[model samples]
Target: MIDVLPPWPLLGAFLLASLLLAVTPGPAVVYLLTRTLAQGRRAGLASVVGVALGNLGNAVGAAIGLAALFAVSSLAFTVVKYAGAAYLVYLGVQALRSAQAVPQQQAQTPPATMKTVFRDGFLVALLNPKTALFFAAFLPQFTSAAHSPLLQSATLGAVFVAVAATTDVFYVLMASLVAGRVRRMGRARLWGRYATAGAFIGLGAYTALSGSRGKA
Candidate 1:
């Protein structure tokens, strides 16, 4: 497997770039943080797993030339991108509605089940076609011409996903620690829910309005 990768220098550069990208806050990080604050550490971790799997699926799609299809077909990319954005907005709306329905006494408890949280996370990641495009555009930079392109791309994509998952886990842990304090204050908890909902809505709007180019 090592032989299929680029030279040591290029590999090191790739690792460094991946780490930097993983640490930078993105849609995934925002979603995880909100999930952690609203639910708990377990839900946040489950979301991480779901998102990782979804991202892995996108990486595989890139390896198999799905990203190439997206590159050439604007309609395909737009359709999937809008779908993901709409879902995020829907989640935000549902959160707001739920917040109003639940009594203040129960505001501290997580309203959604783990399965729902994981499924939402999975859908959020999977529906974003730009992720596959990103893998297609980014992975080839560190791949060697002498090796099988498929193997190199797949390996690099997996490595990037692993790095990203590690960072996401760290974010979840930190958010969980802070969540205890946030939950203690009734007004704060209510406001946290509103903030979470707003974040989701804002992220969705940004995703919908942002340029179509593959962004890290």
Candidate 2:
């Protein structure tokens, strides 16, 4: 049996952690699903691409000294992390309050242009400090100080992005399917807003609590 798996158990750790992380609800999924149900699949996919690019940036940061820099500088890391936490909370509060700005069953109206969608996606992911910290914490588990960690961590990050795209795309498709049928129902749209809002709140709370915790 030619040994194939890396001698590092941390690779498996990274994979498991990535899988769990992908399943967790975040702004990426919410943005994708909202765009899909509001605009269309193409727009949603563009958003996914932007998020994947952002994740790629995270991987690059890990490969270079960025993650290490943050790890070493507690003040910098804390600043970014808390800022991210506050942002998530702000999004949650906005979602909860969005009930008043727009009428129900209008999510499908004023479809988002592709350019707007991509720009929104890019900005959302780039400003998201949680994703940065996520890469910082998760990438190191799959590599070691003695080994060349850049390529390995980048590969792991790619895998994570692939999984996230698949997971979130599925969510968009499912939500879009439901949207087509439920758009006629005012109550259904309201439920979706409430659900998305609640997910945001839960994610924000989790991000705030989980700050700076290292797994594996």
Question: How would you encode candidate 2's per-residue C-alpha lDDT over 65-147 as one tens digit per residue?
Answer: 66676767877666766665566566567766775567764654454478866766665665555566667676666565665
TM-scores for every predicted model: 0.94, 0.67
RMSD of 2: 4.7
- Number of the top TM-score candidate: 1
Clashing pairs in 1: none
What are the lDDT figures for the candidates, one per model?
Answer: 0.88, 0.67
Using lDDT, give the best candidate's number: 1
Q: Please report the TM-score between candidate 1 and the true structure.
A: 0.94
Model 2: residues with Cα > 4 Å off, grouped in runs: 1-17, 82-109, 144-147, 186-210, 213-216
Q: Which window of 10 residues has the lowest lDDT sum in candidate 2?
A: 1-10
- Candidate 2 overall lDDT versus native: 0.67
* Candidate 1 lDDT tens digits, 11-77: 8999999999899998999999999988789999999998998898899899889999998898888
